[model samples]
Target: MQYYKKDKDKLVCLLCSYYCKLKTNQIGICGVNKNTGDKIECLVYGHISALNIDPIEKKPLYHFLPKSKSLSLGTVGCNFKCPFCQNYGISQEKNIDKSKYYSPKDIVNIALQYNCDSISYTYNEPTIFYPYAKDIAIEAKKHGIKNVYVSNGFESKEVIDDMVGIIDAVNIDLKCFNDKYYKKELGGNLNQVLENLKHFKKNGIWLEITTLIVPTKNDTYEELEKIAKFIKDELDIYTPWHLSSFHPDYKDLDLPRTSLETLKMAKKIGEDNGLKYVYIGNVPYENSTFCPNCNEVIIKRNRFEVLQNSIKNQHCPKCLYKIQGVYPKMKTIRKTGFAGSFYPQEKEEILKYIDEFNKQITINGSFDTRAMIVPHAGYVYSGFTANIAYNICKDKKPKRVIVIGPSHSMYYEGASIALYDEYETPFGNINIDKEYSNNLKDKYNFLSFDDNMHLEHSTETQAPFIKHYFANTQIVEIVYGKMPFEDLSSLIDEVLEDKENLLLISTDLSHFYTQEEANKLDNICLNAIEKKDMSLFDNGCEACGKLGVKALIYSAIKKDMKTKVLHYCTSFNKTKDASKVVGYTSALIGY
Candidate 1:
């Protein structure tokens, strides 16, 4: 709210360099923020116009999380009115009341659910939505997720200061070196953008520069060299310069498309000016990342899809020269975050619990099941219920097992798909079905990656059981929060289409209730599952993972699979405290 200043009867917005002064009920030049006589309110705070999961390279971010996915979102309106803006359709359109509202948490959850490495504020100038972007950035930082700004580089110094830690990386547009053109043609200040570029670099935000080379406009050698030299002298030589081609669009429909030769010329100018990495965008040919010192291809790319990255430990494989950008580890392993407490630390202790549970519970016959519902609580509490399913399904021996559960420790909207090479358990390491997981993620917009969400005990507790029962089989863990059961059910149905894939849905019922109350509530869930009656869930079945349970039920009903409850118990069985108890259960769904 302090981003604005009260001047007499008018308020001056300091979010951008324009410094727009507005009367009561007046909006700023961006058309998205309004001065409501008290404070400047972002009209598009929760309104999202465009949202998608795109490759990091499409942000044109060649050096950051290369080959990884990013959750790209933007609202309508912009500070600049460039005629040649390729996305001008949305950027220039200011009436955004019809745009759907997504709270900051929802956006972050979507990013995590999609397995995106970062969240990019793009398609329009992010500075216009500073309040919205700042909120989302704060939430994203909490989960160790990175934030990116695709800006025109004209943010006010105060906003840039706020972005120092929140914004991890940026790709700013240095449209041209001509201040007259910036002011007249683009309705922006070249000096302001240039100053903000230096500010972003000095502030430690990973910086990259892009220039859309409009034919006969900013494609001249002299201007290109000036822009390149400015980057070399002011910014570090390692800063990447992207020379993007301009196509006729929107107001500039009569203008010709930029030739590849002009982009190559700009790239050459950047290199000649001591820039180490210069890429050509909007071209069909491959643009590769090379070692600055050794001049060897460090990362190979076919447009946006990275084919190969040879940087190892942030160094060039050829010369061991230090690289200048963020690099993801070649291999990722999700280690046991809840093993010692949630289950057991030692392999023997875990096996002992399994052995004891097997001895204690006896089911009549083994069933060939495609899906099962298990409780995710400490072994002393719910191991007996969970063991029943693993003991029965071990004979099915599906090639891959997918574990879906609710996020108990965090609030996220969509499902998080674990994208690790391996999942660690007390029994041993379980190989993750990377290929299959990636295929699912690539196919669905709701499925994503969140490293922190995978640490939930609901998903982690099931890993050891899977390893002890189905050794050497691959697994995928999906942790979801605030998601629609219908969507998850569709995904479950798709997985069940494959005869060899087993789905494990984790949940615990009626927490911290009296034993009698717990039993009554737990019975509703049990009856619903036994009858495959999803309608009964609304009648007060208080399963913490009710969404996952509902999804499994929906899938089971659609596949016409029969449901059977193997066991049900309350915490009173172990704690001997009937006053307050938690409920647990195990069930199976198959022919």
Candidate 2:
């Protein structure tokens, strides 16, 4: 609410550190706040650019509101100019679209509609639109909803003072400890952010800190030690620190990604300095909470979901030591969405269907199946074909399976990896190989935990089959939207280096057509895969996962692996309706 003072026909704005004195029709450094005649007005007061329901852990807040969802909202402009900003498309741009306007009442209503426990101001700099967020926070408190700020921690004293009673928690980005990097690379002052850290803790707000550790920029052991020391000495040692991996994005495309070893080193340093809790973000790791006294695992985490927790009533069950963070009062379960919709949900019926399909599969001499290419559709049409390939691979007794498919619902840049601890099926939950999944993401900048992977049928459809055959083996699911063929092939080769790892590619050949037309189109794709011919992909293959198939073929040819076609069929076989049908096929790749 602190705005302007008129002095000799000029307006002086004191909202942030950059107290700009503006003439008529002049804007501040934030680009969204401007002076109009007598007062400073925010151009994006009621406008919203992005909104969604996100897990509180995804905001990297480990110490506050664990295992809950928040209604997140963001406007258009930002004050700082960080080159490696992830949300630069909306944060750095000044083109405001007024069509998507939501008042304070509307925001609180949307939060209640989504069953969210809190409202988060994130994605862009929340300080720029502080007026709008303040109103929403006040209204949300009336409805028993908390307010959070995912900010850069560069606010002025007036702003933090105003948020004393309203803002319940904050996850601030302590980008780096070097003043030169903040001045030259981020257009910010390091001292200001450090001062805000002490202010936030002094005001008794739940404070958590995050640092995006870029590779050669701020990932040195010495620099990391200073950051850890400051948090332990200046702020309380109980403050949770989140060390996130940086992917090359926006204006910094040539920089290398942060490695897993670096994150591990930072975590060790934070612990050595007496910090209670430290977590690695963006890439998966053993990111769980432990009791500081007894070293017992209090809470188990797999990406954004909390798998298992032993913290009872905010105290460790083993040692009876008190834990620092908030714990959920009730148990939570992640349900299966594709069970009743795509196939049978009953266990006996599902086992009967798999048994019937297995009876039709003819497995010859034991083939060491390292990888497989299968189809994903309704069971009546594609189940028999998929069963043939799964039967062959099941003989190998692989310890872990990696499933890759194409995305149909959302568009993302790289491949999306599933972050859930266990995938649900009619039989039971299948354990996920979290260590291998984290290594893949840490080694390649093109892999991330995208929410779209949760809604994708291409990967989820294969869960029941894998669970039925490889009951004890772990699984890793990946979905690609748009990625380079060579990049995926490279990742495949890396994964296949371990002979115990099995790769499965899911796709359906040729959409709706006559039986004759379906076979003609399906045969071309099958022949190309069989012959290891990359050029055959250009001959109208019509496979929905042509990119993944091509990548599999390319990697197989490079590794000198053999390909075998197990079976091929169509939906016409089940319905006896030849007018419109979909093609399905199965194949295997091994030594």
Q: Specify the highest-lDDT model's number.
A: 1
Candidate 1: residue 150 Cα off by (Å): 0.5
1-591: candidate 2 lDDT, tens digit per residue = 566678787887756666678888998888888989878898999998899999898897876777888999999888889889999988998989998779899999899788798899999999888888999999887555789999988777788888998998999999998999998888668999999899999998889999999988899999999999999999978999999999999988999999999999999999999999999989978899999999888888998898877777888899999887655444322357677766787888777878999777667876677889999987877888888888777666667889999998877898988766677788788777766778888888999987646677788788888888888678888999888989999999987788988899999999888999999998999999999988888886888888899999999999999999888999999999998998888999988
What ranges in model 2 sit over 4 Å off?
A: 6-8, 326-591
Alpha-carbon shift of residue 306 in model 2 (angstroms): 1.1
Structure candidate 1, residue pairs in collision:
113-448, 114-448, 115-448, 115-449
440-547 per-residue lDDT for model 1 (tens digits): 999878999988888799989999999888985789999998878899999999999999799999999999999999999999999999998998899989999999
Overall local distance difference test of candidate 2: 0.86
- The prediction achieving the highest TM-score against the true structure is 1
The segments of candidate 1 whose C-alpha lies over 4 angstroms from its true place after superposition are: 329-423, 426-591
